[model samples]
Target: MAILSSLRRRSAAISVAAVAGAATVGVCLTVGSASAGTVSGSLYRDPSSAVVRWVAANPGDSRAAVIRDKIASQPQARWFANFNISTAQSEAAAYVGAANAAQQIPVLSVYQITNRDCGGASAGGAPDLNQYQTWVSNFARGLGSQTVLIILETDSLALLTCLNSSEINARNQAISTATRTIKAANPNAKVYLDAGHSTWNSAGETANRLRAAGVQYADGFFSNVSNYNSTSNEANFGRAVISALNGMGLTGKRQVIDTSRNGGASGDWCGDDNTDRRIGMYPTTNTGDNNIDAYLWVKPPGEADGCRYTAGSFQPDLAFSLANGAPNPPNTTPPTTTPPTTTPPTTTPPTTTPPTTTPPTTTPPTTTPPTTPPNTTPPAGDGCYASVAVNQWAGGFTANVTVTAGKSDINGWTVTIALPSGTSVTGTWNAQASGTSGNVQFTNLSYNGRILGRQSTTFGFQGTGTGPGVTATCVG
Candidate 1:
């Protein structure tokens, strides 16, 4: 098996009626490649309010221990401090304290200056630019040793329709000022200007808006902030935005995305049951891509974004459901595992046959067919010793092969093949393989002894395969 490649599917908005009415549906979905980074965090916490609720609900409940353990175990998940800080100085001090104590990065949502959507479907932000900057400067002061990930005022730059040029300019100025203040306060802080999501903005429009808002002042922009679109589509949109940013001369900047609540892309923009989504990948290490940094679980899975479910409350059941817990089922597509096909060998006869005149002189004629040369390489579907596909098994498979002297052993080799579509690994060996809640793990295999100088060892398994889709590679 070779290194599994990332598959990305763009989420194109299609009408449900059209899909349901079709005789056959061709679903092209991409699987995200396994990455090595972690970002853990709760959506928001109202210390005075949440602490009381937690204590009241968990009195003598063993589940509390489980919850605490789960949260503590994932150190990469940062704790987001999201509350209205009345004064800039106080808010800054509080965040600084939290960062110092946690020894983990803190993700903050700067919301007070804006209308915050507290009363209506789309609320406005501060009418006064001075007040907004004053608040931002205070917010910036809280930087400690720990880094801060600032999601500057969600949808402020987005709701452009409602605001006049003056209002929009004020908004832009506020964001620019906030970014500068924060950076000055903590040079290490990563500030991502919010870009709503793919459904909300076209690539060209987003780039224009980002540039107008002085995007260069901030580290980069963010997308899918609080929406339910698959990571695939978000990634695609992010790439487009990056291109647009580059067009504006802001090259080499990187953006982060909110992968929270989008286990799958939403069917509709608003109120669609499908829009109520779950989470996928967590905050990851820098992607190393020039334009994209990380895919983060910004919105804690299952939290309501004023979805009328519980009026800005966290619905555990809903959260779990989106997390593939209940109601909404998890995607059970199997990993890909099929090998490429090989062509058969061809045969040809000698250019000239013996003349019939020779037959007159000879007493008897002897004809012999030409022999085909042996194929040194392993044939397709043979599962030969030289090249074994490791991820063919359902869960994960491992085998051991011996190598003679003068041969190089391919042992101590590990291959992680993606299971084919509609199938999954039910079991594994040499180590334990487990598949729970849509995640699969393979471990603990032994491969020992060197092959003779030229010999080789091989191990592999055959499980399921997936996708009619090709692998996705990073362009740059």
Candidate 2:
């Protein structure tokens, strides 16, 4: 609801400003950078679904392989650890196991703090604050190294309207305590408290909440963690919130956004009856705004937010629909309409006249012409293409690819590279890759795999490159 409200305000402001300035401007000048990133993995759930069941059923299925490959291909991806405090220990163990076994990159998003989603749509968190803090501390301990980009709680600060003063204070204290505990546990961990988004809370109000929650102790705040608003709008909103925070003397704080489902911002609220909206943006670590740390796929793109199916249940169909851009009108099957055809009659008349003609031949002087070929090779080490370095490690390979071409920007482009035989790609970044005998194909590997242009991203992976003396070729 807060996100929806914020989006409404943005839409109105943008519209009014466009109309008022249209006369002088002649054309509407919308100024903003696009977001980029890749949504490689599904929202990991303990209980499997139809798709997951299928993946489990077929051990080496190509579809399952593609999904795994896509996930393993990306170096860093935002993983939402949605386990509640009640099951925090087990969930944490499972998470650790998955991280260790997969050797996939981890960027954790810790949800389940305070009343999630303002008690409107989501299952609320710990009935008391102490339990919440305990859960958070345990969760932090579980995270060892593996550089976590922790989203402290979703909508915790934004959903403060429902709580009384005492309740609010208690909740804020709990968050502050949790922040200190997590940071103490892992100094390398980048903890981000949720600041909701611009559409949800005014900059001043959100800043007040962040201050109350002790944002100073944390890395910064997170915005648009699980909503569908454009990164540009979210960035502007984040800047405003940060500015307000700075005004409140909370300066130099940063924020990250959930770019998992916001390919484009929705015009309506979460539960609005309107069905014409489509999902925009994929998942990646590229943020258009420099101040924003990473545009992570905080919300698993296709996971329903307690709407489409029995509220809070994982609906794979809905997830898939949302992933592939949620087309409107629920279940409209027809893609196109057939056009009627009209045929025209054809008539031909032939008249032949025979005539003898003598051909005149003229001899022209022959000279050898100079031949030169146009330059076909691209400029060396340009942004258009990147030559990534792959370091073959024990069970897999490790490499860090630096992009100076589109640093801190998201550009839509694909990355193609080849890997050596017997070496299956375990993971990657900025894009998804499918591998054959010796050739590994990366498709839709945009800047950060899902970000716009002018951004820099790092992807690393480990794989069981089969056979002794296994090697891989990094060819784009």
Candidate 3:
């Protein structure tokens, strides 16, 4: 397979539902009898991911719903590729901190090793081994005490052919030091060195390179990070590498496979423009394998691999394709509308569980503003229209309001949402907010202010109390 472009490297509130799924099963690694057993745990889902941002910016696209539910909702590794040594610590801290708040483990990929990607399309990193080591140290220092998984320097070992013997030695030494630095900073953090994919290197050779690059200091090794390889094949390769590592006295190491885009494996490893590749298994600690640590989405799907578009940029159509092609793609069938009922039901089942007795004075009635199906379009008028999708829990809810311009393009727009009596906005993204509750106005940010004719942009907010039955009104 062409591995030249394979190594390209590229939240959220504490939901009670999410925190309940944060329990991770520990696996004891043994050389013999490494059965395919998945562990159990919830990976952190970043609300600010590229797909989420895209979904928020273009909610009116026909494929938005599928992409939103499939790709944007999964947990993927956030790559720390830019060689900004100074702000590395703070950036790492902020991301890990958010995951910590959510009671989930954060998966991070460090892609700035010196000589990364062998000067391929994804090339560029810290100037030298010394600088790379320093950057790694700073990034690790900010990981805090929470459990985090780190995929270290993708293709650093597998693509060693581009370097001279001296350069290879230097690169391995640098990775070794980086791994040690990360482990020393946060013992709770699990570091996995890159072992390339199954198609790139044989198990023994990959194990040898991983050992040389300090696999002994890491949790294990990660494979298929930016490639398209089936999970079963990658797992088998991982077991073989573990066997090799065990023979070399590096026992008890585990592996993580990038199940981001391996649903349909193809020989062409560059931009998957021609292939109909669907997203692989959803990210989780549950890989059902003793030797496999976790099945992660190392490469965020929909990102161009430097072929169809610029590398690392999100393409909505591509994202939708991957999502729609999944084995169990999100339901895209629109709900059929029936004629209006002559009389509203007197008693509707409660959308939320009722309190034992009298509810708190501040709590809104759970039955008020009955749960509406997602993608409900508001009444249209005034050269613009907006739609509301509400995801509600007992005491709180989140709303994604999509504002679309009419026949003419709009330079800017403001959306006024008349929230229910008891509802109040706590946080908002992709737009600026004016009011806390009723009659709240969200104005597009500078970047997302312009909407081409008939195009849409979305802004979301977390709210307290009941949701609004009213559709949002937009003005340019």
Q: What is the TM-score of each candidate against the true structure?
A: 0.52, 0.52, 0.62
Task: Report the Cα lDDT for residue 158, model 3.
Answer: 69
Local accuracy of candidate 2 as per-residue lDDT tens digits, 1-476: 22333242110000000001100001111111343322122222211212233233444433444432222112223333243655565555555555555443355655556564445434445655545665776777777764456777666776555665445545665676678778887776678887767666677677767876778778788876545667788888888888877776667788777664565454444422224333444333444455776656554333333333343333334443443333231212322211112211010000001111211121111111111121223324434444353333234333333332343333444444455567665554334657633555554443244433443333333344641122222222
Clashing pairs in 3: 36-288, 36-289, 37-288, 37-289, 38-287, 38-288, 38-289, 39-286
Off by over 4 Å in 2: 1-87, 93-97, 100-104, 266-279, 325-476
Better of 1 and 3 by TM-score: 3
Each model's lDDT comes to 0.43, 0.46, 0.66
Name model 3 segments beyond 4 Å from true: 1-40, 329-476
Best by lDDT: 3
lDDT of 3: 0.66
For model 3, residues 1-476, the per-residue Cα lDDT tens digits are 23333332220001111111111111111111122533344577655555655565565678876776677666777777667889899889988998899677788877787666565555567886556766887898899986888888776776655675446545765676678678888988889997877876678778877876667778899998746778999989998999988886678999999888888765455543736678888776755578987878887887765556555566777787778857542233322222121321111000111011211122112222223443445335336677775645567666656778888888989888889888898877667999897799898887678877876666667778886654677888
Q: What RMSD, rounded to one decimal, does every model reach?
A: 30.7, 29.8, 25.7
Tens digits of per-residue lDDT for model 1, 281-365: 5444444454565666554443343334533344444443454432211133422221112211111000101111100111100
Report lDDT (Cα) of residue 325, candidate 1.
32
Ranking by lDDT: 3, 2, 1
